[model samples]
Target: MKILYWNCCGVGNPATVREFRQLLVANVPDIVFLCETKINSNRFQRIRSICRMEGCLAVDSVGKSGGFALLWRDGIDVSVQNYSNSHINSLVRLENEDVLRFTGFYGQTASRSRQQAWDILRRVHHKVNEGWIVGGDFNAILNLSEKEGGRSKPKVLMEEFCNILEELKLTDIKPCNGWFTWTNNREGDRLVKERLDRFVASDVILDKFPFLASYVVRQSRSDHEAILIDTKGSKPNRERMGHKAWFRYDTCWAGEQELKDLISCIWEKEESNMLAKMDMTRDKLGPWQFSRFRNLKYKIKGLEKEIIRLMDGRTDD
Candidate 1:
């Protein structure tokens, strides 16, 4: 299953609506979650028809801002449990009888109301028994590394955000293509970028779909990039068939001590030819990175099982 989430800023403009349709055609996501729609339920009916989605639940925008909508194609069993301005919580049953919960979330843009957003998340979390996946524009970053060229984010706010994720046992799925998901679209010194949008999933969901991954699609009309969660993983780029894929370094890997150690180990192998050493390192890095991701998934699965066991025991009391 593939899910796409975007904070489209506003879809009232004809150009913006066209761009949205293009995205729908390109990604062909099974479900789409939209934030900051800036339209009422009546207006959203036009959008639903344009997208050709058969199922829809919309939270109308107040005056000029902060609307949300969740749309799914026909034959996808989606039952909405509850929704407010901040979130839409739903249960999805696949054709194979596997069930999962999905929450389309939008965090409060104001600092003071952010706590309220987290509270809503907690309430939704309490009701979910099956695997869960939450995605949308959170309006906040988990850490300092997520933002660039901005005044430092408040440490307390970041800590609170991290604490809630830990309490809920939700793990952020790192994006495969980019570091930042939102940019201020300013020139030179005024430019600011942050990963304000993401998808977080319970360990059960991650374990069940080991190939699952998140990707950032380039922005067309909005400040935020669209986030795509692919349950089956990314497909090979057919355009690049038989050609070597370009190797671009991800700056995020620089902070990983394991990467440093891996480089050291590769260099220590006694090959005097520098070119050969570089080739060998590239070959080894791919498998090493894959193993690290696999290991983390396994660890999450074990932790989730233990937590479930303890919760069950408590419920019996």
Candidate 2:
């Protein structure tokens, strides 16, 4: 199953809605959690239908600043456990007969209100069994490296957030696709970037879905990038999802000067049209990328395995 979350920042905006719809169409997530919708309950009902989801529960905005929705597709059994302005807690029964507790959270912005947010989360967590997966904008960073281009956050604040997770027995699942989740959208030195949104789960759930991982997705607008939590795809599904058997530019290749020069030289050729140039570039990069660096990726994977073996002294999962 795939789960997606985004801090939309607005619900009434056409562009935002379009992006949201496009995401739903492309990825086909089983569950979706939206934050900062800035809409009321009645309006959210309409939005749910527009999203083409079967069931939903919403926390209406107080004025125009805060609102959220939890959505699930048909055939998934989801039960609400608890809810508040800062969160919507639920019990999810997956189709494969596994069960877990899910909480879609949006932390308060102010320091004082944020404490209340944490306190409530602690209280709710004690009521659930194992296999807990909580995710969203915590509005709190657990370390210094998670934020950039801004004044340093208070160290005590970071410690408090980390302490909460440690005590709750939750572990962070680092995202694989993007380094940051939000930006101030400001230019120059005024800009700020943060790893505010994430998914955390208890050890039992992580063990159950060993292939589960997250990818951070960015769109044209919004400071907060969306997160896609893929839990259904195992090793085979993953291979089928990727390795397209066709040529495409890997985003990671942009950082390599040799690859850049190769593309530039090919692109400068007397191309018939834009499509021809792109096809030629892809044809050239395919073999070159494989010959030089594809094996490097596998070597990195082997190194990762060695580290895991050193830590656990076992190759079996």
Candidate 3:
């Protein structure tokens, strides 16, 4: 199943609402996590109602500026793993039996407390099981690769961030598309983009489910782009290529003309019997046969399309 994680910046704004709806429509993710909701439960309820229409159940922490939230599509078995008193963090257990730990951190803009937050993250990582995933707007860059203009400059904050990663034994799941996930709020030439949002997995988790595909999505209003990840298999290419075969439909027969004649004759005999015979045919058909049957269905569907095209002229009159 596909899962999406994003920081909406704030669902309170109309622009963010529009972008959120568009993303839900485009991706159709089974699970969605949001950071920096910037609204408490009562105010968030309205946004939750909109998301419910997309078949997602919204769970959130109370906060005014930076709150964490967990949302999942309906009919999937999920539950809250736990939540801290601080709106900075929350956790949820997904249907796949994997735990998702989210920390909606807005680290101290310019203070030693950033290091303390990183240390808390290290502790949280240690407390969680090996299969869990920890992610959010880290606020502090992990390494030089995360920053562009400041690449050459030494960043003490980033150094402390790196130490936390090492201590927790967590590694980044690099994005396949975008290099950076956040941008500075400034006009024109003064703006800078940096990779601040992140997805980290333990060594054991990566080894077990290697086919994880991670990438960043572009949304105009928010400073941060959304991160998307899928951890269903070990090899993405192989699994993606093979998935079509798993759902292929075909039909088997001694003679194509004979089968057509038989179906037509059975329909003339009795509509009920015709459906029964079709069911029997379906039951007898192997995977290859089912695939062939689907091809024939498409051929008939093509004829129906042409018929509709011809009928369109009469409707115009």
Candidate 4:
């Protein structure tokens, strides 16, 4: 099973909605948790249809700032336990009859009100004695190293965040892909990046699903990159023998002149057989598309390597 969490900033923009649809297509998560939707509960009906989810619980935004939505696919049994502006706590029963608690959390953005978020978490924890997994944009880093190009995070703040997790016996799951899940989108020295979004699971859940892992997905319109928690560390193979894979065109590529140029270049080649030409186009398009849109994967790999080197006390001069 897979659960995806994203702080979309807002879902009102058309571009954001398109990106959300694209994410839903690409990941096919069983459950989706969205933060900062910036829309009322009534507006989420369209989102539910887009997600193809049968279960939904939405928390309306205060004015234009904060909102939360927890959506689950058909056949999943999810019962809402408690909810507020900062979180949606649910008891989920898996197909195998195993029950677990899942919390979609949003930490207070303001430093002064941050304690309220912790207190809320504690209150929720007191009521549940089952396996638990909590995920979302905590708006706080575990340590100074989790941030870049920003004024140093306060030690007290980091300690407070850490103390809560320690008290709850929740362990942070390291993401296999991107290190930083958010960026200020500013240029040069003004830019800031941090690993604010994540998943923390109790030992009970970790022991139950030993292969569980988290991955940072590429971002499009939002500052926050989506985080996926996979109960199985690897994706299940769905390919069938003797079946040809279908290729679907993305609408987002329609406006790119480079795609037209690439097609023109392919068609201009000396192949006269129509079927062969189509096959050639498909083959060429795969690499071209990856290079165009999936370059972030390479960047993430490079960053991981650099981080490993730094942690090992080695650096290129």
CA lDDT scores, all candidates in order:
0.85, 0.82, 0.63, 0.85
Which candidate number has the best TM-score?
4
Q: Cα-based RMSD of the predictions, in order?
A: 15.6, 10.9, 11.4, 7.0
Q: Rank the candidates by TM-score, best first.
A: 4, 2, 1, 3
lDDT of 1 at 48: 92
Residue-wise C-alpha lDDT for candidate 4, range 1-317, written one tens digit per residue? 78999999999877898899899888888889999999999999887887678999999999999999999988888999989888999999998888999999999968666778888889988987888999999999899778887699889889988999999889999987657888887765777778899999999998899889898887768888899999986545566222133234689889999989988887887755778778877877776676676676689779867764442231223
What local lDDT score does residue 103 receive in model 4, on the 0 to 100 scale?
A: 95
Off by over 4 Å in 3: 53-64, 84-106, 150-154, 185-188, 233-317
Q: How much does candidate 4 score in TM-score?
A: 0.76
Better candidate number, 3 or 4, judged by TM-score: 4
TM-scores across all candidates?
Answer: 0.74, 0.75, 0.65, 0.76
Q: Which tens-of-lDDT digit does each residue in 164-241 have in candidate 1? A: 899999999998766678778776667787889999999999889988989877776998889999988765546643
Question: Which prediction has more favorable TM-score, 1 or 3?
Answer: 1
Clashing pairs in 1: none
Residue 102, model 4: Cα distance from true site in angstroms: 0.6
Cα lDDT for residue 15, candidate 4: 87
